[model samples]
Target: MATLTATILAGGEFSSPTDTPSGRLDTTGAFPFVGALEVSNSVSTYKGSAVAISSNWILTAGHNADLNDDGLPDTVWSGDFHLPGYGVFGIAETITHPDFSGFANPFINDDIALMRLASPLPTWSIFPSLGSAMTGDNITLVGFGRSGYGSYGYTSNATLTDRRFGQNVIDTLDLDDEGSGLAEVFRYDFDDPSTTGLPGGSLGNGTETIIAPGDSGGAALIQTVGGWKLVGINTFTEGYGGRFGDTGGGVLIAPYEDWIFTETGIPEPGVGCLLSVAFVLALWQRRRHCE
Candidate 1:
């Protein structure tokens, strides 16, 4: 594995190593909706990440759905999704966005897809609400990707079964990333706290990190007053692999919200207005009692 010198963020001085290859593990079972995707055909098997958006619908990167690279989705592909604690479920169907360029194109856009599970997951399964990402927003990323420290980047020794959590802030919104002529994406750099004057200003939240192979289709979420919202779907990265200073981002969910809802028939959560009504009713009852 390769390694880089550790620099302190404050004074630009050398410092002892404080980062590790393994991102913070999700041992507490906080992310039940996030899961691993294993799709296979007669020739090969592909590993990626996905998140449950509804009881029977899953959201993932478009590339994962088109494993054969036929310009059309491999709807007939055999696959199973493994959600921690919930057991594995077979995939019934897949739908990739209409505008997604095939894998042959280096500058692919509209890299989003949805899968229907053979059976509905448990009602208690926590599906993240849909929302948009903005620059400087602290986002939570969860996936079963290769693991390694920023100093050395991702290592091939890691397996896709290793579920990990990390954090980073959105630094830029690229409207024409890869010149795909698509909508904007939420992009961020893997900042090393020890390094200063890096692009995006070394905004490491201690857990600063980036996505690796097998992390495609992972969840990029943001916490809102209502709850956690699914904001981006992990797609691609640029730089010397997943090393520090590399830029990685995913398809923003906002631009594709209508398409997702139309395909899945799942409505966005109405918690915001519903909660307000409930609170107002409770206050009225309390005043009536006081009178």
Candidate 2:
């Protein structure tokens, strides 16, 4: 078993070295759909984060499934996904994006993957009808990995079971900083709300944060009119450490929504209407009332 680090957040007040278990674990159960991923190969075990997008499907980083960088799933690697209050489930299969070129270059892009669970979860989270992400949009990041304060970056603490949530605004949609000719990726910086010298100029939501090593497959979700929609998948980070001023982002879900929906058998919001007739009727009524 391998213990992996998680995410780091701005401000020393948000985290402390003494905060055992993790810097911040979501005890409120606000994000039950987010979970922890542990995959083991013949050599070593790897850890990451994942999110339940459907009853039997999970979303994660491509590298999590193809740890050997062979552009295919490791033959000996077995995956276990742990959800809060839901216990652990075995991954039946994993499907990495066809464009993922492995982790040789940090900026290669197309780092998304889908995992099918052996058994369906009782519940899951919903995605936007049209997947899209924009600059200045605040996104909620959730992951189960290592933890530390922005003042010093990620620590050596091991807490793979704790899930933490934080917020940060999208600073750019262009992958220029990640190199040219790469697929689209949305980037966000870890901003210190008390300082204005950062790249995004102190755009922190107070709980601003940056992902650490084990948080590679975590989620970057944005709230929408319908509900919370997953906009990005945490893939890579560009910084000395998980400290202040660090920039991180992942593959934009919009461009791969078609592949995801088709592979996972999850219908687009307005396509097949997965929700029950009564539920749809209630949602329609609610929308009408708001209108």
Candidate 3:
């Protein structure tokens, strides 16, 4: 319910992209986190957003799991994971922080969720790597969230921008009583004359890259160890100031690696699924040999 203003990149005006061809996970050369999260209740299925941080796990907002507005507990799901060019995979597991409550108070820190897969994905070409708590560095953001007054849906590719802040929650929202997280990353809008304290220049200017309906739990990457590193997971986003100018919030990932590892232990869901398949294959092999 809090609001802030962010500048929108004018038509025909946007950031320059890396000349390198975007890989398979890249959606429209923009934010690929838009269509990742898919929630299923008995009545119907709703699509949230998510990003594949590791081969077997995905990062997403915790609110996606809070099924009822009353905030008891929602059925968490990971089965909707899909690459732009790849088919959908069934999620074998869902995990969240043991301490996550459906409330927003501390502002930042506690809005991230991770899901384990039954098997690690062999490949996803265009996916961006994750990053950590270093500010001012540049990164890209893409989502199917609201772009402008008339814009919506997933992006085919991502837009690059300089990061303004690192590892902090910029905003928060309550979804049907369940709290959602928002990770703040700043990008400058060169087009806005008032960018430096201009009248409508609170939200950093660029293509409005905030998450809308389908973008949650997507990965936030930073350059580390020679490649883009996974740093944060999209948790919550809201239309701050006006609707166009807004910020996204997510959970910083590095701190949660241990929890993720411990919670998702070895012989992961993926391994189990693989083992089951193998058993079936072995049974078939024995039958054929006997025949």
Candidate 4:
């Protein structure tokens, strides 16, 4: 019941890719906390975006976590899937929210997921603060998704290897209240700049950075009083290609911060780098596997 633009692989689809339109590669100087998520079926490889919420934990989409829908993964890894800014890291498992009932629940929501890394990240890695997204906040969407726009965009099976970032303002929020297909997520527009007053406004002046197939589980960041906030995770889009009026959606992250902390004992410090390796060593030795 949900229509999306994520590149399809094997039998699953990825919401957006690593390469965004007119964006640049994110290095430790730019986007060190973000990384590329890679999935494989032995012979083939696919990509998605992964947000490192903690030193040893990654936040991504539920679908990206387990692409096969069988609750078992053939292989999962992050970081070195693409580009040079990131280093390769292996994912131990995909942990979906207990309340997430796939993408077709009556609420039409809850696609959030997290992954555990084999080791803890260095202290230099940043953890974005948590903030509530309102209707008018400006958002920066980044990914290594497909390159090009519309028909020129890469195919669902395409494997892009670059990182890019785009900008758009929040079109709407609390979508479930609208009872529309966009329920449970926030939306930004890829409208024509000529089309003023369009919902969420067009991409506006300068380079229009819209999410394309391959960016699934990437970061939808919003700046707050504290600093840049990790507001959402790339979920889906209305159109497959880079057509105009295409809307990108990501699950809200602030709502689930508590669950993430309780499960992994990872501290929640959005702004600045305060991740203490000493605090999480015990959990590291006694990692609890999720169902």
Candidate 5:
């Protein structure tokens, strides 16, 4: 485990295991919903990250469905995603926010989308809800992204981590390019081990971790009275020259609760209980360290 933290403009890995820092651990137990998208029927063809909001519906970044500029997809991978164990799930539908433009100005307005699986998952998992996020709140990020930054930029498939979780604190809310206030986004500081006075990050091993390229559409989990609640989906990391500690935020889900419930047919948020560990949805538990 190497403690090298940098923004994955798009991924990273480490050298020897004893490099004086730390490495991201595999997220087999911590995140049950966290999974990768192997596009075009190939695991080696890392499309991006996706999380199961419901057994039959997955949540991911809107841009994952973007078409290639040349209009030829052979240059870029597309189509159904192949999940290990669970098999392939074709994209029955993709719904990005109507107001969403590409990753240009005001990217925070709406960068999320929901994908309905052609088939349902084997079991029902605890679905995350649209909740509030405030600055200084400690959150956990879980993704199937690479481990470190590479020569060109963030490393991809370098560590080949299936699921990686890290800790980070909310740094700011939404502010547009010109420093004007925006109503939709919440930002977090990307901690570089070199910097002093920053949150420990989502990875609790004292290692400063970040969302790599493959981490797109990952889960930003916040501690709640009822275990951990999924609040935001991994979206963009804004920084100059792909540096660490840049502003990374996503579409605040709380505001779109109505749209998410209506579109996905997951039923309106009425009663949600812990699915895996079998806890009451209203238990109001606290995470051990992130609190």
Candidate 6:
């Protein structure tokens, strides 16, 4: 499991995770992977995070799922996820990587987690539409995070913000020029600080947006192809704002298309085996001719 630590900004000071209330929305909008997360611990009490990925598999941060008292990953559990109209669903299985280290300082490694479901949920499986790749790329950040505006509720809107490379790192998008298609992977660090509009960003005291306790594992989707495609999972945050009052924060989303293929293995094992056998036979004949 990778040691998962919260990153506020690249060089900016760190801020603790806060459970602020995000304003309420219609709650009728599509929430992908809404009810897909559950925490595991016999004694220690922990709240369930979000699971914003696929139907069979759920994606989260390594810190939220690492509950084995030994800093090692054991198993994650989910009774149900708190969806909008629907209630929670019974979680079947949880798979946490043994290499996670939770959010720590010096932000060197990655902090990611995974969970599996016994039964699939078709309605919740549809991923959000993704948008173009560019720095300052306008995107929406929806979740049950702290509003930082005095109220505690879930937020749902297609707000715009700069889509940086990573949340905290120096690398951001080069939106000045763009290529065609959406095949490029635009990564954004959670801890990267904003330069201009933050409360303290310009003064060297700015923070980044953070996903509080309830917002863990939620989805950050972008508009693309008349639909929403997931970009990252709600991870943590610092204290800064993007276009709106909400500053960008750290997130841990599963790699969109690539992860899907890996989790749902294409070509099937049987088909792969058949292809391998045919290649071997052909090689054997070629060797015989040489002999």
Question: What is the C-alpha lDDT profile of model 1 across 1-291, one tens digit per residue?
Answer: 211110111111122334454435677877888888888877788788899999999998888878766557875578788887898889998888876765525444578888999999999888899988889888888887776656655554324455777778898886744454545577887776765446565545346777877777889999888788999988777777676777778889988888997897666457667888999999999999999
lDDT per residue (tens digit) for residues 200-251 in model 6: 3322222233333444455555657657665655554433332223333333
Q: Tens-digit lDDT track for model 4 on 201-291?
A: 5444333456666778888887667667888887777664656556666777766767788877756454234345654764676665321
Please, what is the whole-model Cα lDDT of each candidate in the order they appear? 0.73, 0.72, 0.44, 0.61, 0.57, 0.41
**How many pairs of residues collide in each model?**
2, 4, 43, 16, 24, 57
Candidate 2's C-alpha runs over 4 A off are 1-6, 13-23, 104-106, 123-130, 156-158, 175-183, 196-199, 203-206, 268-291
Off-target runs (Cα >4 Å) in candidate 1 are: 1-17, 104-106, 156-160, 176-182, 196-199, 268-291
Best by lDDT: 1
Reference-based lDDT, residue 222, model 6: 60
Ranking by lDDT: 1, 2, 4, 5, 3, 6
Clash count in backbone of candidate 5: 24
Badly placed stretches (over 4 Å) of model 3 are 2-35, 69-73, 76-78, 103-109, 123-131, 149-193, 196-208, 240-244, 265-291
Candidate 4: residue 61 Cα off by (Å)? 0.4
lDDT of each residue in 1-291, candidate 3, tens digit only: 411111111211232321111222243434433234556777666655566655666666655565553222465432566545444655676665655554243343455566665666666534444435534434344333322321222223222221111122223222221233323322222222124244434223233234334444555556556555666655554443213334454566655556766764522457659989999999999999999
- The regions of model 6 sitting more than 4 angstroms off are 1-22, 68-71, 75-79, 97-99, 105-109, 122-125, 129-134, 150-210, 239-248, 251-260, 266-291
Model 1 scores a C-alpha lDDT of: 0.73
TM-scores of all candidate predictions against the true structure? 0.82, 0.80, 0.58, 0.73, 0.70, 0.54
Report the alpha-carbon TM-score of model 3 versus the true structure. Answer: 0.58
RMSD (Cα, Å) of model 3? 12.9
Where model 5 places Cα greater than 4 Å from the true spot, the runs are 1-22, 39-46, 68-78, 81-85, 105-108, 149-153, 158-161, 175-182, 194-205, 240-242, 267-291
Better of 3 and 6 by lDDT: 3
Model 2 over residues 212-264: C-alpha lDDT tens digits?
Answer: 77787888888777777888888777775677777877778887788887896
Better of 1 and 2 by TM-score: 1
